[model samples]
Target: MKTDTLFKRAFNDALLLTSRLRDGDPIPSETTLAAELGVSRTTVRKILQTLTEQGVVAGAGRSRFARASAGEVQPFPEAETVPTSVQVEKQFMEWMLRGDAKAGALINELDLARQFKVATTVIREFLNSFQRFGLIERRPSGGWVLQGFTHSFALELFEIREMFELRSAREFSSLPGTSPLWHELRRLRQEHIELLSEIETRFQDFSDLDSRFHRLVNTAVPNRFIDGFFDIITLIFHYHYQWNKKDERERNEVAIREHLAYIDALLSRSRSAVATACRRHLASARQTLIRSTSDTGSVA
Candidate 1:
């Protein structure tokens, strides 16, 4: 079976097996399912989680899943679709970009919690992730203080980002036609084209779109360590750059075209071509970061 079919086949097989079993009947472990279905345990786990989410399965522990009472699977509502954590991150980034807060300013967790309409723990988790990069630090007195960086910091981060993405491009070049990545790339490419066609009205949305595009590209590889760095990169390049609105629309239009080129190169599955495309886009992002630092006129 094709890699794309692995997921659906697992889900369907699990559903079929569950249909014949009583509610109290034990479901197989992820390891058992993966072995039986010839799929990865990761894939099996994902399907099980979906089944649980859709009310087809029940149990808190991974080892305890069993069929739920028979009922129609609820179609998840499109509204309230964004995960609380993701929405929190978005709002927090926006809060920073909107200049509601500033570099060197103290970040009050309770204040942020109220602003984001989330618990203080969620706010702490969001900020704590950035603490790894020294982007934010806890004040000796109390709350967290947002840290500012010199231009060198941005350049260094970009260098690491380029290395990871170039490797990702090389890996992506070898993916088979049945890879789910192709479907994602096609969808994102269409989105790029649509946004470019309406650039006059939609250019401001490019920052978010650019973040998504790069995030998707980096996700092609299975590097867990890079995930944390990617989050900081996304926050800085995508949202931080919003501080400077000079030539914003034109810059965004150019970025949209560049993204389309990157998507095209990936689809061609040519390592050299993808490398060139990736280099070009990363260079653009680095330049944008430098410009943002200059606009802010702050260095630490």
Candidate 2:
């Protein structure tokens, strides 16, 4: 199933690329296409073969050429190309962030399956994953129940978050000057500047930026556990940002500035500075989460 999704996504991308070429234009080489699509050469070959079978391309191997115009072929629907788990997770998060699910609310697998356009089993699996974090609990009869975001849970979660982020920040500070992370960091810094300039209207956009920035920091030294924990953090923070609307703009503006300082510290390559900046930003985040939880009384 996963492979099929990957192939469909790659095929759609290839189709888009082919559409941009004039009729009879030479198809890119397999190696070139693989690099462009960020897929294995074998996948690229499969995509070319599929394209040939669909009458979208003519000839074979290096002699292949575009045989159809953009209007002749249709790309796969955007949703069909994404894995069901990913789609379900995204829908679940959006549902929670939209305030559709309250603390201690029962999770209706059938309803969620219908809402997300997925199967009941998919919703069950997603809820099961959340069970480990105590964010959801399986009911005796069936289905699951959403848990509140308790103050104690917030403290414990942020404690681990700080540890992981601080370690990642320290590793980032030690990264070689030639590392690509430096380029990404610079680009993110520019994005932060742009967002800050228009913060009043764009403050709501900070949730995604916050997630991206932290994810990049974690890239300095990848750990599967850290990556998984970050998923929870992203969802919780996203929920908090949405649920806590009072002073939302001010809160996000402060966070953006803090991120800039954190970025500067990492760029400086100073261990002490990185540690200080990481802790400071994390402390602020901890406080914000605490405040939100207190205000909502949503978390037990």
Candidate 3:
């Protein structure tokens, strides 16, 4: 499992377990909690630290942990921990979605690191991930600039995206109903409906949701190359296109409905139906990317 997810699971489990205890009740040892949760002792330690910070538990150097006094027992802590790589990506995407930077704008590693609370190397590595797509450029002197996609750039990438997704949809159609992917897809479908219901007030949130929905759809495929292309594809089609606010609400509403159709088709387990839905959504995405790049003032 992803470290962040494991950490969260352990955190929640810790909270639930501790809620059952009272003042002066000794909490389980790190090793015991680790074994019970099937996570590392280090993960348990992190959870304990959070609990300590929230006044859920109390201990020090050589002291064993015990539930804090009734008045001292604070509410459960918020889920905000250190930012994971996935979170960094979403923050970066949201930054774009909010028009924080424009196309062709220069980006400094230090500034991005500060903005995202990540290291300069982390920012550099993230930019490197998209280096193959040519939307980011490094200067000989210093720094990077956000680059715009040419028509040729979008068309070329779309061809590869179409191949990858179609193949994924074909394979996903045959997956057993018990597959975890189905559970995730169903969750995504519900999210689409929820977002669509609130589209007018929360239209800007669609870009992140759209990125998540497509990423979940492609999870059945196991090709590293396809995965690499997905980063670029999502950055452009999912986040960048929304830089244009023209009929944004209408476009997002339609896309959410299309996503519901796509989800239903996949759950039907018919290869032909899945293919049709995949093509329809991808074609819409392709058109959006083409239009976004062509519109002079849309980039941000």
Candidate 4:
């Protein structure tokens, strides 16, 4: 399909799956979103025209489109966490649960792209990824609508992490009473501890390393099953917890410290210590999840 048509399909499909909403759904102009989505104004206009032609939305003064009906989705308020793509989608899901129909408000694409500091195509691609997940549905008249609960999705992600991480924690601690890996584990643990000793409150590291840290530890077991188990865990984190921007903190040094403690527990060959450290780490992660409830109340 032509690039012009591709964006229209994405935009319209997103509308169909999502319901109507109330205040603060900044549905803007085609001219603007066209730039935001990185397509031509003609392309965006085509999307608006298509939606207008359909009964889903009505044009507002030839500039914007008001929904044919504003329905009942509420908002899920959250703060900045791992602000990645997954978090964006979770934000949208929360809006759906509130029955907040305002999610369809068009954003200034140029502004959005600028704020994200990324090309519009990346944003568009992120939105498009949701389609395969069945999170979004297309309208006959040509618009998209969100169809899932945001909180439920977020919770589901956490539950899955708990199951995988707990088991991986056990395997990680299964090293021999005296293995060379123990020394390496000791070094990383000490550093992790010193940082944690000076701990404060909320902190987040918006890097793949945060993820790689877990993977590296679990993979240390050198068993196919252990590796496979965490591969599943990794997939969930990749898709569900993908965040956009991380909230800044004064003491993220604590997490690195905890990670080292976890390493120490594993090297000591003490299952209890390993599990305790893992639980502590996961608890902190859960707090981050809770705090990440987006106040802006938009989703991927």
Q: All candidates' lDDT scores?
A: 0.75, 0.84, 0.75, 0.54
Give the candidate number with the greatest lDDT.
2
> For candidate 3, which ten residues in a row score worst on lDDT?
291-300
TM-score of 1: 0.57
Best by TM-score: 2
Q: Could you estimate the TM-score for every candidate?
A: 0.57, 0.70, 0.60, 0.43
Query: What does the lDDT come to for candidate 3?
Result: 0.75
Q: Across residues 1-300, which tens digit of lDDT does each residue of candidate 4 receive? A: 112335544454436433443332446666656666666776666666665565445646554545636543222223322335654545444434344544334433354456555566655666566555434555566445554424454466567667677776686677565656556556555544544554443233322445666765666555675566555445434433444235434325545666767776776768889889888977776665555433333333
- Provide the lowest-lDDT 10-residue window in model 2: 291-300
Q: What lDDT score is found at residue 74 in candidate 4?
A: 29
Displacement of the residue 168 alpha carbon in candidate 3, Å: 2.0
User: Per-residue lDDT of 37-56 in model 3, one digit per residue for the tens?
Assistant: 88898988888888887777
Give the range of the ten consecutive residues with the poorest summed lDDT in model 4. Answer: 73-82
Model 3 alpha-carbon miss at residue 18, Å: 4.6
